[model samples]
Target: MRIHKRDKARRRMLALLLAGVLAVTGASVLTVAAFAGQRQPPAQPAATRMGTVACGDVGSLLDQVPAAAQPAVDRDLADLDVQVADAYRSLMAPGAGGGEQRVMDALVAKRTTTLRNLKASAGPDAGLPGDLTGLASCGIRRDLVVDASARDYAPDAQAGSSGSSGPSGPAALSKGSGNRGSGLGRGFVDIRTVSPNVAKPARTGSATGTFTSQCGRNENRHLNPDNVIVAPGVSNGAHHMHDYVGNLITDAFSANNRLARAGTTCSNGDQSAYYWPVLRLLNGVTEKDAKAPGGGQDSNVGRILQPADVQITYNSAAGNKVQPMTRFLRIITGDAKALTNGPANAHASWSCTGFENRQLADKYPICPNGSRVVRTLKFPDCWDGKNIDSANHRTHTAFSQANGSCPKNFRAIPQLVERVAYDVPTGVRFAVDSFPEQLHNPVTDHGDFINVMNRNLLDQMVSCINEGRRCG
Candidate 1:
């Protein structure tokens, strides 16, 4: 009878685990092929600045933006798209239309309107917000937050829908040999070269806990619209969507004060929220693109792709005892700028299942016949010994060294490593859904966290980590 009761408990937990996957499926993207009649406008010479603020000044402007101002940030992108679409239509319409200069003037006016909207929404509390001139030029620069429907018309817009035919087979390979890595090289170096000596966790405690959620499950709640590290504020939750499998509510509004009171999927009652950018197939179309004015892109387009496995591990970094994860503590695992600026402070990377030999930097790997693609994100495990957050949201903690040891002046905390894999065919090219300037660079891939776990539940995780036991 005792054995029977124990088996019942295990079964119950399993049921709860499966029940946690949120329902997320089908995405859209806009393909230029869908454009009927009107030819694409001729390229105009670059403007001095993109929006009201020059691109060079965009970084500083982002500093003053606030998390509460995401709604306004989203509006700015929406307004820009509306203007671009209208202008393009007018230029291409079968009638007397504005010449290139007219288009340029229209772009300038639209940019000014967007800048004014940002300042008004930021309000006096944030003080004069940063200039938004770059939004027009860098329409797809990875950080701008935009609505799903509007994304189809966004810059570097690839054409395709999720259910439609994606980009045809692997990118045409260079002449000579037929094998992996034979295509025109785009700055891809094997990742194993840099991570060969890295340390794996010491052990899985009996109580090491885990929570699983289906990828592409909840588009509405998971995607992070802007750069988490750069634009901490202006948390516009648009542009890209994500899959979540923990605390129910996660958004610009997420806060420690009320998170504990929210609902959760963790059977143990964990309220922590885990999320990252949604992965899309390289067909040139996505769920978001499908909803555009024209039927979504049907040719190879970008759309959110589901992961074969979504594993969330809460384990010890000390390789000894598990440390308690502080309440409301925030952690950012990968460098968001790696794609555009190179891997200066980046910790995220992509590798193949069997070709573990090559851990790549910014570009996605061209896998062999049967190997699969994997995205590995390792979070910092060293805490400042105090403080749940820092002004930058990153300085409060540090990453464990290659040996898995925290630096001095910091304490070890449970480290989280998220591994997402996809069944991308042998050679079909794939790229992260980022800004047009990035060319789908993989370096932009990243993840974010806000510890809303109940205090009691956090203690339980701590016990499991410290006890050197894995729990689920």
Candidate 2:
């Protein structure tokens, strides 16, 4: 989602993968390789230099809560996130709290009371995670990996200047509204320096087909801060701006009927809602939402970079044929709270155009000339086949195993891979918008989708995949 490199050496990774046909889903099938033409950069030191407030992930614990209880539970959970973020800021304020521990202690005390209330909301049969009281405590993250090749912008240039892409040219590097303890820091790596770490799986599966959705980039500027899948009806649910490519009227308030009747950007009349956090260049320019809740006010400052290309492809699971995903199916890929929750659910894949083989989960990529930044988010392909959504927004679907087999009680479904590319000017730092406490780390990058495809169309997609034909 973020970086800049000062070295002007032009080393094209001819051995790296640019584009080819493959069953793109998860780490199992992905491969990273470096071309033998260039000298390798020094090994990167893998650790975060900055620290941020870390707390128990309350939302991830709930598997299934009553619809009636979800409102209160959701509100309480969202409040918990707010409280932790607030404490993080308090820790950063001039002459802040009793240091990090005291601030964490205070946050834990507050969270204890909230956890009690949340338990009350869920009741006995809600199936929430255990040890709510134990989850109240909070801490700090100091072990996140930092990009060794990270380069800072020219200090004298204004935050909003649209400078050149060369070594000495100044790209937009803003102060994030002077918001301390935020923005990108040592989060970018030179793509040419990374060696191949990905390997093709031992064996390919039975299904060998793909269905692509030709949804154009957000040409109409369909942007918002709502997460209809996870926090429906909650304004500013995401706490950051999102770019939409499918459904035109997907917002915090968009109901099922409204979404069905809304216009779409898809050429084939598919009404699926595809959205993800906006990638931002730190060029010091004021955006339309600079002072809004999800913008500068939320510490997501900078000019939002429109993706140069976005390819939404669905590949059949390797295990077996995929059944059609029901309308209204909701799937979320990646952890928006990964900075605090760790990498268990994180799906970040950042790299440059020609260096797609060298995917970096925690670092932004500095591309060579004519190259651009890229974000690859591959969704889980195994469906439980019962619920369209789950309490935690994840249990309804799951990722296929390394051999591309569905797990127990889970059936193969079309796995969605959202590959978005951005033309970030060379030598400029950029970042994915995130919760202020997350420090806009590239690891927090995520994607959201709602399947509103018509039944006939979905059936057609399934047929295309099962037939081993690449169709759109």
Candidate 3:
């Protein structure tokens, strides 16, 4: 009876355990079926899909992509290259009133198309690499150009027309002093008359004897005794001679002065004009900086000038007002000597003594010791306080202010200056001699100059990147 009871209990327990296992398995299957029945998020649209890749995300995507998909990747890259080139060409094209809209529009449109194509190629299931996505999100759009008629892209309608005659060859008047003689006029010369009766008879003339006169005999008087006219003086010569001789010198000097002034004004204006475009580029990068701190600022900062507030402040300051001239000289010469170092000097520590005193002691009594206040201050230190290194007061004056004197080897490159002013991040050291040679003739096509410059910069950047250098 005991054996029978034990066997029965064992059998019942075994059956219960098997039933429990079966029940759990059934439940899991049902749960999985329910999940399967519900729709998953619809796969990203094929048109918009980036194949799960992002900008600058090309490396990883390139890795995992099968050999079959390599062709597609290559096609996409080719398309991007073409679009970018087109955008650049459009930008270089002349626009209404020579405004920036056309170029900007082309860049933006090309950027959009490239992005769209990239997305389409990257399907919902496309396994894109992480780095590529970050790059894609960089907001580097090709549609930088816009219609000249567009209100936003259009230059200020109220602003006065640019006095510049657009890009042109060297001024005709700038040739040389010798050219002035042939092309314009020589140093003043006077016309004189010799009395036939007093003058020696010409060999071919009918005059009889060697005629002479008391007036003609006085060589000093005949030659206009008062050659150096300190004030209005009488010249006993033909009125035409006096008028032509006297006025010629005065007119030539006056014209030369005018031309010099115009040239200087034009050069200054060109430098300042570039500030606008550079500001735009910096502003865009700043937006990116706001989104991703400490990412591109180092590279981009090299291209941008200090902000307006900083510039204004520097100008307003008594000691620093002259700094811009010095800074300009330094840039041209690449010499530190042109830059100065003194308390009152724009590049010196004393310039900021006033601002520092006001901010640290007067304004913020409650701030804790060693606390960093990040308020924006105009003319913070001559140019823009941000560019200057407050900590390194000894060397390296801020970008806003002058540093040491101009270097001994300071050589000027006008094109490089223009590039810097324009915030072109590439091609600072291109060969200027080659510019004219490669372009055939610079007088007719200025666009070629710009193209060659850009290409040179692009090549440099590529080379740097290939060498494992950081290329913002």
Candidate 4:
């Protein structure tokens, strides 16, 4: 009976040992499953996922993954991280959806395709941990900000003028007005009446009879009941006014007459008249002969001129060079206050120094003989006949004469004034005193006339270039 009891005890001990071993094995299996599940969490929120994915933390996460699944898991996590980063960057990037956006999107798409192919080949078991995905999210945000900033601070693009001042600011004298006394004053001599004879006869007689023979010897005498001649009678040549001054006088007279008829005083005199025609010309009224309707001439005349067609000519003994002028135009079709400043008043002075430096480098690389030439002319220097210097230099000179100064700089060139003459059959001739204080030399304290002219020329050239016209 004792032997039987020992056998039973031994069997009982064996059973208890087996139960302990089974319990340990079950716990081990549960632990492994839990670790495996946690390592490969489902896609989480971008912010939270990235926070958990520390760099170089993949090894610890992979410890729970089976040996065979390890490679697949790693590849999947890497791809997911890359895709998440790419997605975030795309949405946050500046100008992301505009024209530039497409370029970046293409790059992201190519990378995504590559990653997707890698994941497909690696299989589903090869997935990345949540931490890796989170890191990718962080990287995406960083890249997006960097790309956006780069695009935002890029260089200023050359955009055509957006309602900025441009050539065609003011109206110019019309071509038709060349002969007619249209804008102001007693209209110029009738071309029909004055063309046949250069001079008007003192007394009314047969067309061929001499004035002295037809009338009494007295300088001022009545030849017949109907005819009287004044000594030094008006001649077509004398009556004709072609120069700018003459045209100005005629315009002033016309303006004054209109004002008088309207019961208003045209008290502004020659200055007012001179500018009036210019303003009219700029308004695209090419026919100087066409009168403003209803005698509203003076009121219409005072409006600011905007030049559409500008002609700039330089004439000297050497030859003549002319450039089509363009005014910096500001359209005032919508509002009358737009007419306040004329082209002359609104001109901007380009820096002479900058122009000189650029031009010299471009054109005068070598002297006429191909020898290297050194640039001696400096900024603020004016032509003083024999030398170029800032001091003791003359400013304004006639187009025919250089005031003894060499043409080393653009400021020294003379601008000629052309006006329509009423006395002459042909329309235009030169004018006296068309040269204003603005055109005179600095010694005379006449303001910077040369600078003004140069600026005007440069502005015209720039406008032409902008308009896609050949400046040459």
Question: What is the lDDT of every predicted structure here?
Answer: 0.47, 0.68, 0.20, 0.21
**What TM value does model 2 have?**
0.79
Model 2, residue 348: distance off in Å is: 2.4
**Tens digit per residue, CA lDDT, model 2, 161-248:** 1111122211111111221222434455667777765555443655677888899999889999888887777888888899999999
Clashes found in each candidate (C-alpha, N, C closer than 3 A) = 60, 7, 42, 48
Cα shift from native, residue 337, model 4 (Å)? 27
Q: What is the lDDT of residue 132 in candidate 2?
A: 54
Rank by lDDT (best first): 2, 1, 4, 3
Candidate with maximal TM-score: 2
Tens-digit lDDT string for candidate 4 (88-203): 33433343433222332343444445445544543444333332222121111111111121121101111111112244321111001122343211111112222121122132
Off by over 4 Å in 3: 1-63, 95-99, 124-472
Model 1 lDDT on a 0 to 1 scale: 0.47
Worst 10 residues of 3 by lDDT: 429-438
Worst 10 residues of 2 by lDDT: 14-23
The better candidate by TM-score, 2 or 4, is: 2
Instruction: For residues 224-331, write the lDDT of model 1, one tens digit per residue.
Output: 444333333334322344456567766655556556677765556667777776556654555665443321211113666767766677665546454677777778
